[model samples]
Target: MMMNMFFYMGLVSLIVLTLNSKHLLLMLMSLEFLVVYIYFGLFIMMIYMNYEYYFGMIFLTMSVCEGTLGLSILVSLIRSYGNDYFQSFNILW
Candidate 1:
């Protein structure tokens, strides 16, 4: 129960940080934090449920793919804009 509370608090803080951040890099980092926290929760649930290892492996693979894609996008954005600030993104405008 105590561990769960800590996990929830960490998740909530990461969510708030992601929402409130003004820089794209920080947002991406927060997103990674969220993904990691979710994965951790899933792993714990899987262990309690006695689930198969393949499912966890698949989830890890997907998470890595997503994280890599996010990082690539971040690098491209930084190269194009010279900074990671959110306000500089005016594509929709």
Candidate 2:
């Protein structure tokens, strides 16, 4: 029960962070928070249901890949433009 509450709170925080974020790094951090919350929630559900495996391992693997890709893009952008702000990447400019 407590774990579930924490998981929900984490999700809510993730949403709020995403909505309020103004930079790419902040957005990425919020996304990471969401992923962590999802993993925790899945763990709680598995424990309560006595499930041996939730097959969410694949989902986690994907998230890791996504994080790596996002970071790589961010690094490349920063190296090229000297900034990490998403608003700085103007397609017209």
Best by lDDT: 1
Q: Give per-residue CA lDDT, model 1, range 1-93, as digits (tens).
A: 868786786778577775867887777777777777777778888889998778778888998998899889889888998988888878725
Task: Residues 1-93, candidate 2: write the lDDT tens digits.
Answer: 886788687878677686865577777777887888888778778888998763678778989999999899889888988988777888526
Pairs of residues at least 3 apart in sequence or in different chains that clash in candidate 1: none
Best by TM-score: 1
Residue 63 of model 1 has an lDDT of 85
The positional error of residue 11 in candidate 2, measured at the CA in angstroms, is: 4.6
TM-score of model 1 vs. true structure = 0.81
Against the reference, the lDDT scores of all candidates come to 0.80, 0.79
